[model samples]
Target: MADTLVAHHPLEFVVSELSAASGSAVTLTPEPFLPQHIVRLPAGSATAAVAAQLQLPTAANTWSRTADGRAIWLGPDEWLLVGSESTDAAASAARERELLDLVQTVGGAVTDVSAQRLGIRLGGPKARTVLAKGCSIDLHPKHFGIGTAVQTVLGQAGVVLLALPPGADGHPEYLVLVRSSFAGYLATWLLDAALEFTSSSSAAR
Candidate 1:
């Protein structure tokens, strides 16, 4: 059995700990929506709507939005109507109701899952190698470029993976969004697997 209380070792790869202060964990359930991306007709009146929306443009198979955003394509035909966190959900709900009233059809459903999911960031020269131990996806920059968001299985947990802008410090970093309930489990697994590499760095010192 692996010793859980192994003393920390000095190593080349620094371990930065990130944790949410709230001891309470979050549970995230995927609220699948139909018509993933949203396309806006250029002629539509923008002021008639109560909330702000961001238009994400797709380029090179990545999600992006321009300055003065017009429409956002979250997936294929579904686009999230972006709004401030302070904005009332009732207003958005009203908007959804209005859309339904106009079309008299179910367009998309919004589910509240704020309690679930924890966001984490990991990056370093050895980051890619460390991540490869559990993830099946090719994490190489050549294959998984920046701005990419992928949902895949990682360490027996469903994870929402996103590639962010490169580090200005010239290091590689990947953004990991995992269910808060599984956050501790996944973190322990990752750190445990990294022990050898972490220990090796100390041995080299």
Candidate 2:
């Protein structure tokens, strides 16, 4: 019976239409079901022990790829572990348990938050421009270069935004992690704003 269950993308209803109707200068793809965990380390405690176990970005507003996934620094005492896309529930559960054990040993905590948010991969020449319409933070390369991660507000939605490497189009790419409830709204709003840039495309849902 468990095997009969199906996993659906949060934006399943709108992604296809959004992709077909999006502007030429922008590409939006849903990175559904990425394994995400919230890591909290108490102040000045076991930071060294934790570092010995996992590779993490200790600096504020930055992230680094680890052997497992990307570890993003959320605050001096908080981090976000974002793993590759996976649908294996058993494997994810095992991972959560492993992390929980690790954190418990070091007096920290790990919270499995995979289902709490959705990841939207946004890229292309107008990617930053499109984001600028809704995001107040400066996304210029000089400021928010590759590997930068920050928690910010995008179009009224609270998000953990990451600036990834440039795409083949020679422009920046980005990953936006927003609450699942607001994903549809953000996707629709993005496509609507991008309509002016690509008049030939159809209307966004």
Candidate 3:
């Protein structure tokens, strides 16, 4: 008999619900599931060693990306390494193992948390407006720009918000990292908040 496959993402059950909602002002979609490796680097770890291992950012609340993965700074000595999935299952597994080895070489502890969290992408002209309804952080471009990241609360759920490169229209895009359990709740909350904008946009047309 074949081994039981248990891998699943929280948003797998809600794709239809998300797709039915209007996306005029802000669009919400689940990011392609990927392998996320969380690492806790100890204090006093050499900056050069950490960078050599994973392109760790030098500043707090920032992220650096490589061809296959991205490294986000969670705090002074902690980081989250997220790896993109490859077409081949075996290739994906190999890439994950390679990242694990890199962190281990630097004496950092690592955890495969790919299933523990969900990635949500929020974009469109009014993306920031929709987020401001629930998030306390100042989403102004002057305060938060590409490469900025922060762990904060969004509608009673804890999340990691990362500012990605803007869209062609210069509108901001944000990647919200939420626990798997809270994925549905946050998605609903966001859609509800977005209704106001969607309705207004429809009226103007």
Candidate 4:
């Protein structure tokens, strides 16, 4: 069975047949800005390959493969890759060719999930609070930091959380990637939870 990844946020939502999600409202549009890039490394060569290309100061700390070639980065070398679709078809193909040439053997396998998955954005001071209601992982910038990525569970759904750079307001933004099937449900949940802060909005002014 294939799943579609979806992006859910205050700005907009995108659905695809892949398993990875990126971009967030907090990182773009109405708040701070954060760019996300998700990729799969060639099997055992992920760490070495990324090291060679990106030239990280240190080797990646973790790297694992999904049933497909979805490689995930737990630390430095590890990263998770989910196959999905994008509006820029040619660019996607070019990226695939580049990865193939940059790394070793074609890891394990690949899946054509140009249908599942979703993308969403979370920003503002209330962003953390909204996510805290469902996620056990700490969203505090002190722990998560900017440009950091983590794979964790949110409201029982598998998720990839990316911390974006600071916004114009000097507030940090966060990008949340969740499954498409769960977007509507999660959006409703987040809105309901955000109501509490509304009561205090007038006082701040």
Candidate topping lDDT: 2
Q: Against the unseen true structure, what C-alpha lDDT does each candidate score? A: 0.48, 0.83, 0.79, 0.49
128-201: candidate 1 lDDT, tens digit per residue:
67677889999888888776766677788787676667565566667665676676677766665555455433
Off by over 4 Å in 4: 1-50, 54-86, 105-116, 198-205
lDDT score of model 3? Answer: 0.79
Per-residue lDDT of 102-130 in model 3, one digit per residue for the tens?
A: 66665767776777778888888888988
Which of the predicted structures, 1 or 3, would earn the higher lDDT when compared with the native?
Answer: 3
For all predicted structures, in order, the TM-scores are 0.55, 0.90, 0.86, 0.58
Q: Candidate 4: lDDT of 179?
A: 62
In candidate 3, position 149 carries an lDDT of 92
lDDT of 4 by residue, 1-205 (tens): 8997554333344222111121232221221112223444443545565544533323232233233323335544344454333334455455555554554354522332333344455666666777788888777877777756677777667767766676666777765666656665555555555545543333455
Better of 1 and 2 by TM-score: 2
Better of 1 and 4 by TM-score: 4
**Candidate order by TM-score, highest to lowest?**
2, 3, 4, 1
Local error of candidate 1 at residue 170 (angstroms): 1.2
| Candidate 3: segments with Cα more than 4 A from true spot | 44-47, 86-93, 199-205
- Most accurate candidate by TM-score: 2
